[model samples]
Target: MLAQLLCKTGLNSLNLNTKLFVSLMLLLAMATQSTAVVAQTDRLTLIYVSEMTEMDSEEKGSYPKLASLLEHYRQINNHLVFISGGGGLAPSAMSSLDMGAHIIDLLNAIEPVAMVAGKREFSFGEDVLSLRTYEAAFPVISSNIFDPITQENLDGVNDSLLMTVDGVTIGLLALLPPIAHQEYNLQRVEIQSPVDALKQRANELRSAGADRVILTYSCCYRDYLNYFDELDQLLHDGLIDLALGKDEHLLLADHQLDQMHPAHIWITQGDEVAVVELTLEKDAPTFLMNWQTDSMNAYPADAQVQMLVDGYIQRLESLLNEVIADVKTEFATFQTDVRTAENPFGNLLADVIKAHADAEIALVNGGYIRGERQYQIGEQLARRDIMRELPFRDQVVLVEVSGEQLLLALENGFSQIEEIKGRFPHVSGMQVEYDRRKPVGKRVVSVRVAEQPLLPQQTYRLATRQFIATGGDGFDMFGDLEPLRYAGQSNRLIADILIDAIQQSQQIAPLNEGRLIDLSSP
Candidate 1:
């Protein structure tokens, strides 16, 4: 047809060389247009959530609702990938009893492609996490964590994973913060630098034929602001295609950092879910990415997941409903009260831990108390109540520290008082007087242990949570000091100790007792 049309249009009148050249150019143009029309585009949607624990609250994001939302996406796009950004494994009433097994069972139903190993995953210790990993249907990954004994990633945990979604090979890596070692029961494992691990694994994945790489990281403790610079550099350098972050419970719009690299997404709260859509064109090495988030409340609960959640809640309620003790006065567990100043409940907790350890003094971080509610006078405190308040199963450990070191620890506690940090000391056998108007390290005006003036040279037996004794919450003054053990020194869970104390006493009346005095108060 082209030859006949060309002859009629007077192409035959041209010389053979010119006619051939024009014909070749037309053929080339036709091939280019055909390739453009035949190009294939694939879409991958990633559904992300983190820091989830309980499924009991309708006000918050529940696993059932999450399941429904996932199904909605799967219906629209078969290339949907669900990612658990870690957390949600422990520190709840049920998790305290079952060591997060219920959460694992619930997640199995959701069937995430990968679950990041956040610090909370080690809340019950490496052994329990190893067991949980065995139960999980999906891959549990942490790129920077390793077991020295195995000389590899922790048992059952992968350093990275590669999956093909709609013909696109996606590489995944999860990173934990450095503080996991200091804050949790991760003594059995070693954490490498997350940034270095990310770079190494990303290159390896690319070399292994991955078309795109995604990272999910929980960096720092509660503050992720400091990690953005390094993440932006990685994005600019083209090592990673997308980055997902956890721990900071704020949506992208609420973040204080206005200018963020386009590839990063921070999904903190369970109530919110983030979706990252990637469009890959056939024969193209790179892809276009888009991100959006929605509330889990927008979706209805999936019937199967709801049934599973209900069964677990019933089992948990049976164990938690028994009345343990009666309170003579209302005890407050408000974050501001417990973290910024002394409260009656904090006093009771410190006293119980001190008595259990048989130590002269006991110090508990305000952050350890998480009930965040006030127990009214005459309210019967149940086993559930205690667990709700102290859910981490933190053990009481005995240590001997000089009065000078004690002073420094107290200073560290008060250092972040302005931020209402968790390090604030809830004391058992000591009275602290401080003027916040003074410099941070020098805030302590005076300290008395057992009603006697503290002697910097004198060493006192201290009873505190293993977390603090091991340098958590900036209590580095106790660095590398081994726990002291003597006759009858039981390193029992702090919650159990408190429960026993309440059960033994039958009735309790605890007061502030002026343990923490702030001269800055008007």
Candidate 2:
């Protein structure tokens, strides 16, 4: 009736003889309301979700209550469940039975609708993946993954989901973290181009009667910002409706869509603010971090969510406790010097390759060891422990290169000695001397294999992870070497050998054999 009255008066003022009537126009109000009711009743409803990782015991910190997400959902009296970033065992748990249970406890309290995959999801392997996927009430979406042999998208997971709220339809699409592909080999399905794939998906949703589409992807902050701008621009132009980014350990920033568009951007974690938009035309999402009277915190954890959390935690504890090792002491620091002319750590690793492959000589770059940390006394270790240090999981291979190719390896390693910070080779079965003052490529004065001068024509066998062998880190010269063998070994990443050696011997010492140090010409 109020809308009718306003509309009648609004129309009356436009006529010349109406005298801009006010109170007398009440009768026409009811008539106007009757017509207005037939106009439009459809609207889009959205509930944004994020993936939150559980904190370890040493790092036990609670996030803002899940009631915040729920309370926001309750306002519309519609269903929109916020979920974790696949709350399973944290990578640090290493199969701890309690890991999943703890996360489940925390998440049940929040009662989210679904979860997206995180890199840590792969920490427990396929069995755990199947277990967690089944246990979740909501769907687990990862579009890019495909089976290695079957070459089909993994079964039991949806590519996306369609939901309706208050007559408003929303489409949710998921993306896997790139690191899951690079570091963990979780690329069971290859990812199609983000922009291309998403555009096609949005069209499909639109054809299926979806009013708006949103993406809930797992990636880093910078990547989120990048795709957000791309999607927001398209959305502002009516290409899509909205894009919600996740995967930062904490909420970082808020980006409002276009000033004139009905789109908004947000990120949230435990204790982070929930962006509130009262109207679509509002200039920005009102940031709300405090538990003021406007927010939700009074509600308790959802019972079903709590049950799932309990089961996951129990399973995790039993599995992780399965002893992988029993060590006497824990090392505080283990220092490794792999750059010197005679690198103890690198030489030991190279010799392993040389012996294992029956190669004449071997060279492995120091960068492969990752940060190459300093180890302390009594540091017990396991297989997963070493794998962490060498996260790339690069395949090990043997290459045969001519003395010129050998010289190239020497030059590359030598160039690193003077030009780069840590590119020097930790070599085995060879000795090298070089001049630091001379320009790179001219720096290596001499190179020898067991006291014999290197012959540019004679081929020498080399063993190294395919990463550097195929020119990772500017070693492109190695991409075209003659193949002697491909050992295909992850049994002992170089870091494992070093850690195990230090753990058992209880002695941590590394010497620089003066591989590339400046020698004042005698």
Candidate 3:
């Protein structure tokens, strides 16, 4: 509604004071807490978002519609404490601009005091993150991340951040699990063991007179289950007020949190926002932290936040909105489809890379096709569409592989079928027949590439994402294969290539034939 009003009032005609007021209203709307919480004079509200991954309420109607929620909270309470759950910088969010700088500017608009560093934040170099953090109003903190070469703390990351609200001191820290840098083929920082790092730094925060401590971890998975007992100990000992973790898209709400502590919270990129209410009292036993997650639909879009987001979108729209082609049909991909069998979308993406590199064969990990939503037929494909769909920014790599190595790669791709890993290859120039019933290494029943049966002695030129080329998702056979194209160029983002290819073709309706087949006992 605010956006509509501004649109009619001639957005450009709004004076600077009016714009600022609208922006503040938007912030208040976004910060608004769920009404389910028990209101009291001594309570402080902390709005926590994790694995945001560049997702804003404006981008999509995901949970905790931030702009309007902020506006809601701003009007209700003056002492709301907003903190980020990290994973703020993602390729989809950064495709058109400097993501770190842009997100920092955006986060500043709502005035969050601090945020933890999620693992994906390391996708860009530390120098880039450092520059952005320097520009951010809030602290980008991590207790365990550090520079690999100098062994010093990263330039812009801190071990902890302290925020004082209403005479109450709150301390927050971020912990990251060891990452797959070898598999991803990029390195700028190293991480320490999460358990030891959290224990030590948390003690320091409390000793320094922090009345409450909040723990944030960027590794958003149940993979951190091993540390549950340790977290229980921290809560029982009154060392931390809250703990935040994101396991995929799962929303671990207050009920699931009862086992860990009275105040445990989990949030994802979209779908929900965790609002933790802290009740500060004279006695430690009486102090309370209550968490609730409300959907983004719970509030309306604040005019202020809508305008700020509009500015960012409008700045990029002219170039990113250009139509590349019209899709004749819906070529969609879902988690089950991409991870298990070949889908039309995967076939199209793999074909795009194969055509771009002019390689005889090409494949991509299902993990990189992150358009969780499906596209409609007859929709005009644009740069923005590709950006949202294939956001990983992984480059294409052409490599030489023998028949035996190719077979091994295919076997590796299907080896983790039970786990549904992204390594499952979607091929462009090959037909693979595999059996999940067979042993892991012997899963490939038949492999034909470039219209020929596999030959042991012949080496084939294969094009794939650098993630696979560098053995990501456990396709290590590629590490032995030599680079056949763009040997030293690892930054040619496949998204850009896909856009260009779509423009040149003017239309795409990739075949969904027998490229990948699964023959196994159900």
Candidate 4:
């Protein structure tokens, strides 16, 4: 009768009174299987997490909050997957070193299955990425990035990862943006297009008897849109199940399956970043969780996780204390965008480039310029903070190029801003415009120097960064320019100029200008 009742209660097959108590517990779990279900011996569960930069104090108090959330999840389930996107590489003593360590420590305690590289993972260069991976104590995978010469993968320890969870075999492939390769001009490493590589690997995984194949990619929306149709077709044909994307700054709401396509798709914005979540079961249902601003209340900080973050903060504070306080100023912070009306920092940088190169016109990449918040007077500025804003130590170069070269650089600088929104060139003495409605190459409609029409054959002494001079961000035409001179550490020059300007006036007030042509309406 007891056996009969137990069986009716869904515990029948287990001999609870016998030595198989553990086995009976597993059986009961399978029956309930609703809230936080541990996978049965035959089932596997993966919790995906991503876009965790800016969770620290530099942005807000998000660092501790994220750690706490991870810890809470770790206490219940030991399987977590992390894919961090780029953009948190701003210079700061706080997260520069300790951010990844703290993130890894908490996740390791939870026992994550694997962590794929997001583009931001490489935002600080290869060395910083290596250090973070070493400290992670988990698998770091970057399959697409390889050594330029050796062609060996630069993923620290492991390249690709396969894990058998809950009776399901899963294969993971990672990819990065091609721009990263172009930025470093990596000789050995080549970043394959995600679409091309995935199809081949998906076949390989399927032939190897894998039940599911997932792609964790860090790329912009344009890349995703370019390949979305093809990927959706793959899912419809049952070739690949899930594709997660990072790199976009905005958060997308969780979306449902495309009615036209058989498969489901979603993109998540992390806490100050974003990630995509995919559940392999029931045909790969996907969802997007915004970790940056939303989704905070649901997952409060776990005490244990907060403790780990505190330790990292302490280490960072110690390092920051040693940085010589350069200048004392009232509360003021500079925005990174430089294409618009010049901020104090931007104007100062322009002055530095002009001084260093003795050129009439100066052009700087909007990539520099940090300090999103206001700095108070008596605040001792540190070199580290400045460096954070200007992470790339690109030198300033003087190029005596024709007006045509200058015009090309301006157009390329403003290339993806309309589509991607933030790639613009800030200048000191020139203005340019292009028709947005018109095709690429023909977009530039007008060009002027200090209100004077530009002369195509006339050579101008222009000061610009080394990266742009060599066609770093699609300014390939500039590489043909006659070399006038090389000014190293243009960032340093700008920083020094800023310090002096602040000291002389003891006041720094900058404003935004609608200088660069905005073809948004057009």
Best by TM-score: 1
Write one digit per residue (lDDT tens) for candidate 3, span 1-522.
Answer: 111111111111222234334554564454344333524356666777665555355343332257668667655665566767777676464533564566666776666656676666655556776776667655667777767676656776677865555456667777766643433444467767777777787788777767777787765554455666686577677777677776664535455656666665666546466777777553556455567876667776666666776777788788778889988777676677788888888898898788777788887878777766676777887777778778665678889888888888888788777766667788988999888888889988888877789897898788898778876667777776667745335566788888877788898676579898888745
> After superposition on all CA atoms, what RMSD does each candidate show versus the true structure?
13.5, 14.5, 8.4, 9.9
The TM-score values for the models, in the order shown, are 0.85, 0.52, 0.81, 0.71
Q: In order, how many clashes per candidate?
A: 1, 40, 24, 33
Per-model lDDT: 0.77, 0.49, 0.68, 0.53
Highest lDDT model number: 1
Off by over 4 Å in 1: 1-41, 219-222, 247-256, 282-288, 436-440, 479-492
Q: lDDT by residue for model 2 over 1-522, one digit each (tens)?
A: 112211111100122123223322542454355544433222222344443443322122223334444654545522223534453445333233333435544544454444555554654443456465544444555544545555544544455556543344556665565435433334244555566667776677677766555565654454444455565566666656554554334323433422423444444443332343222222223211122122223345445554554565565555333334434432211223444344554555566666666677777776555324444344444444444344433445678888888787777776755323335676767777777667878887888887798888997878776656766444567776655644444455444444455555554344445544445356
Q: Is 3 or 4 the stronger prediction by lDDT?
A: 3
Estimate the TM-score for candidate 3.
Answer: 0.81
| Candidate 4: tens digits of C-alpha lDDT, residues 333-408 | 3433443323445655666676678787887766555555565655666555554555454567788878877887
> Candidate 4's error at 163, in angstroms?
1.0
At residue 25, what lDDT does model 2 achieve? Answer: 53
User: Which stretches in model 3 have alpha-carbon errors above 4 Å?
Assistant: 1-41, 53-65, 91-97, 179-186, 223-229, 237-239, 251-258, 268-271, 402-408, 415-420, 437-442, 451-458, 475-482, 485-492
